[model samples]
Target: MAKSTRGRVNAQGDGTSGLGMVVRFTPKARSEGVQQLEKGGFRVASSKDFRSAVAVPNDFDGADVQYFERFGIAIVRRDGERLKPMLQNAMQRKVISAARPERSYRALGGPQTMRLDLAQVGGVATSLDRDYLLGYRDAVNELVDRLLGKKGAEGLVARAAFDETSNTWGLQAIRAIEGDLSGAGIKVAVLDTGFDETHQDFVGRSVTKKLFATRSSEGDVHGHGTHCIGTACGPLRPTSGPRYGIAHEAEIYAGKVLGDDGFGTDRSVIAGMEWALDEGCHVISMSLGAATQFGDAPSDDYEQIGQVCLDAGTLVVAAAGNESSRPQQIAPVGSPANASTILGVGAVDRPFVPASFSCGGLNPGQEVDIAAPGVDIFSSLPDDKYDRWDGTSMATPHVAGVAALIAQSDPKFRGWALWARLIQLTKPLSSPARDVGKGLLQARGSGEV
Candidate 1:
């Protein structure tokens, strides 16, 4: 057994209360690791593989279990004093690589204040309010200077800004090179609140639907899912308004992970993701996240699952979050999105300026991977509604839809290869890497994969 490389476990709450933690094991340590932990008296709750599980102690001092497969994370509760040493022992035995306390997650966007056409989801919301956009100007300038030295990089930066003069700015901002490639054969799954099956924009479109929320219906009571779906896979010539969707011909898979109340646990999220992968979705777009503070570690379960998805030719994209105070403070990328194997999308306006609410990243496992238009973006809502909303939530599906287009462009591109194509095709922005990442997403043109 190697010495545990992870730091000492800290008690999250009163030592007497049940606490949840996720233990991530190295690939090589999986089998031996679970065996050793079980032998040490830890109770195995549920697991997707021998590599991970929801473990618990026999009592306040022993282990118990509650397993979550979608996120590949575990939820355990017990006195920290009793739990730490056992986890430390597991680490020392080379059974686990890292461990962290579990917390709740939330949706990144909200209902339009003035909209009359849609219903809103409710929850005990946590606001990620801050102002930090102006402070990073110098860092962005310095990055632009460095980028200018590379061949073609300056041109890329110059082309990053989009024409915001029109109402369909998001479409133009992503540079959707819509030319024959309508994501024809690609399967895209959007895991969120649910879908508005009655939305006219999707009339006659083929869709695969699933409900993961306990006791919840598949129809989208909250409008978030419909709005996101509108951006990623809506009709090319919508009933009204300019063309808003990116992959008009894509096969839509709507998985309702969040309930009508706009809240969900990791269990539901993980279930949705598993369903998406099992259905062979080429791209999975998650516009929701649990808000996190700076330096928070990425989820080990999600990292492993993301890597597996990539290995199987699936690409997962999630919102970087809307917690930035812009120029003053920048929050870390949120869970699922924080996984290095998944693409984390930050928000920029039509002019290629970083959204004041968009999160930035410099942490090892929480870097932002790309940027997309998110502000004042128009898309479909429930009950044949249409409205413009804002959040990194809006930015995520743009990248997902474009990824679908890229995948449709060339059969050879999938998983990490498709991820690389996205970065390579981006028009570099003058913003710092922590803000806008590789730059704004760009779709391939006609006859170009």
Candidate 2:
């Protein structure tokens, strides 16, 4: 695991007391099967409209098995092990396809979530001195190592700021997007911690939010979701710092898969996926994932579901994970991202150098599909504010926003073609393929819609 950012993850109490178990049904889930399961004292609700996939009232009663009818999958919630056999029976009764316990997912970013530093997620109000010290220490260590020609430093220096302009350096690197394309017609769903409806820049925009995690509503308290949403779909002419959003004119789908604590379960994420698919979002951007040990295969359920998203004309992208600290160690791509069908994105600093903490394509079949600027990225925060942060979590949205742009440019770019076009347009980098897959992302010369 090489000091993985993804250690075992568990969900905060959703005012419920039980375990979350995921079950996939045969073909499309049948009404009789769902009704029968509901009758078994297992109430399920994850804002899923089995008919059209719209966000409805999904207030938790006891525990709702997060159901995704689009994929015939339902995350079963039951007290104790009482209904284990019934679930097993369903697999026999032709209602269930596959079943497994839900794994934990978290908002991936530079901040070691275990510490929960506000500045790490770009909260401008709370700046602790220790944050500076730690950042400096890591920066100095890597800088000196690179200077001394020791370790795997690669003679790279981490910059304090990527750009001095009013936009993020990531947007600067992919300057081609600023032309005519603004992702006006695309819909991007960011399934992470909830979003901040109070953010000033996003006011009056076409933003839709839904809570899959246990929370009062679709709001960001942990700050990761707001930051990620800002990078992916924030405003272009904001009343703030550099422009951070990619698909500035695109509709925003903020799915609160991870709770305010920045942690979520498979139940929340999968349920969110269902909701996004139902909403007909063109791109589903997930800057969240679970850790994976070496030799760990990607989740069968996630892999299948990712392919399903692609088959349905939506592209799913995820953080390759900030699990590895380079110069001495490297880690496998994380779960969900590690899944072959999902596009895994690694992180590079503003200098176009692979981040010391960015995981690589060490695991077979879990190769990093792309790389993007993730270091010291400045973006919107909750209280009409902005700050700089780091991690592959930041990189995932950059690619996702680009996907939306390419999707809007032409209809043919949907599904895997979008992936192919992106690969075709990347500017080659000197970094190893394992670190920067297909090179840095570049916007097409013309966004001819």
Candidate 3:
């Protein structure tokens, strides 16, 4: 086997002491045997057999197995390994990876579980073949190499943050944040699509939090939020060093407000903000923004809320909407972000060139704060993995994480003091005309800047 890139297992005490076992079933069989196995007192876990097309959570013990004409197979995950010998004898064997890693943080009030991953499921004969299974393993091996490969070839790292030679702007952002204060005791609240809580970069360090803004209590449904979180707080495991997030050791409060479709309501976002504040989070990073503009009354509501945040002393950083230009000229950014007091961020390329997708002066000639590398940034993904994706959404957290670092360096700064310090520390890039407010964000800055 090629060098296995194992995830950092949190092994303080006895590992695998948890009770949960996975079992595979035999290949296509004409008999209603699986049902008989279920009837014999076994619980059904999860099934990803493409042959059978049903994906839902239902209890299946003693009566869970059913044979369908569509695909003649019976597969199930049971509670214990009581029937391991029977299963090994009856079905062709394949490998299994833990579906869910043994999580360190449990829900406020929930059950402890160690879920198993169903890596592959096929005909027992073909699946059991050593070469065939090895071939499948090879594909996975390639994905891991791509995920961690520094040299640009077929890996996600190379795809997102490397050009043939060096790290891209997104990777640079990762470096900046990771450098000075990855260990700051700050929490960056990320509300986006779902994150892969199972990945190695996040291992024992991740702390899941609810986003009251989401319609459902589900975590990031889409992968966007997870990647962004990686930028803000991806844990540094052994194989991956210097790859840690800016606030690498900082606590992450994941709030999956965006659904699988990547669309969320303003109400949901507002709720997420409130939750973050309630938790006493000093810095909240919102890589999301509204595509449409708000009218006077709605705008006023936003300003009022922004002032509330100011009074309560939390920094709400939002993306300047990606939509830009003439016919569809979106005005003065969007709700929440457009609020006079809240910081509205626009994107600039690596060379300080404004991204075409980055919305321009909504409140022209006014202070736009600072700009950082935002085009394509590399960040953490679910599992022991990584990916490079683009969006001002990804960029916002770089600054927010920096805010966490600053707080860690000097804990006295809170509310307006923190916001003022950020603005005061910013190095102005644009002159009177083209670039309005500040240049890029500088971690070590002269208070006079």
Local distance difference test scores for all models:
0.73, 0.75, 0.50
lDDT of 1 by residue, 201-233 (tens): 999887988776645666899888999999899
What's the TM-score of every candidate structure? 0.76, 0.80, 0.57
For model 1, the stretches where C-alpha displacement exceeds 4 angstroms are 1-19, 26-73, 76-89, 111-167, 214-217, 445-449
TM-score of 1: 0.76
Tens digits of per-residue lDDT for model 3, 235-339:
544245345356677877776555555755433454456556666777777777654333221233345456677788777777765666523553445444555
Q: Against the true structure, candidate 2 has what lDDT?
A: 0.75
| Clashes (candidate 1) | 20
Which is better, 1 or 2, measured by lDDT? Answer: 2
Clashing pairs in 2: 43-64, 44-64, 44-65, 45-64, 166-242, 166-243, 167-242, 167-243
Worst 10 residues of 3 by lDDT: 103-112
The reply for model 2, stretches above 4 Å from the true place, is 1-17, 28-64, 87-97, 110-163, 176-178, 446-449
Tell me the lDDT of candidate 3: 0.50
- The better-scoring model by TM-score among 1 and 3 is 1
Residues 1-449, model 2: lDDT tens digits: 21221222122222254446566666754565677678887776634443343333344444566567666666665553655666666666767666666667888884432233465455365645654654665677567656865532122343433345676778877664457788988999999887886789988889888777854355788889888888888787878677788788999988888877888877678878878888899999998988888877677677779889999989999999988979789988898898888999999875576888888998788889988888777787787878777889999999988888898888998888888888877777667989988888777553642
10 residues in a row with least lDDT, candidate 2: 1-10
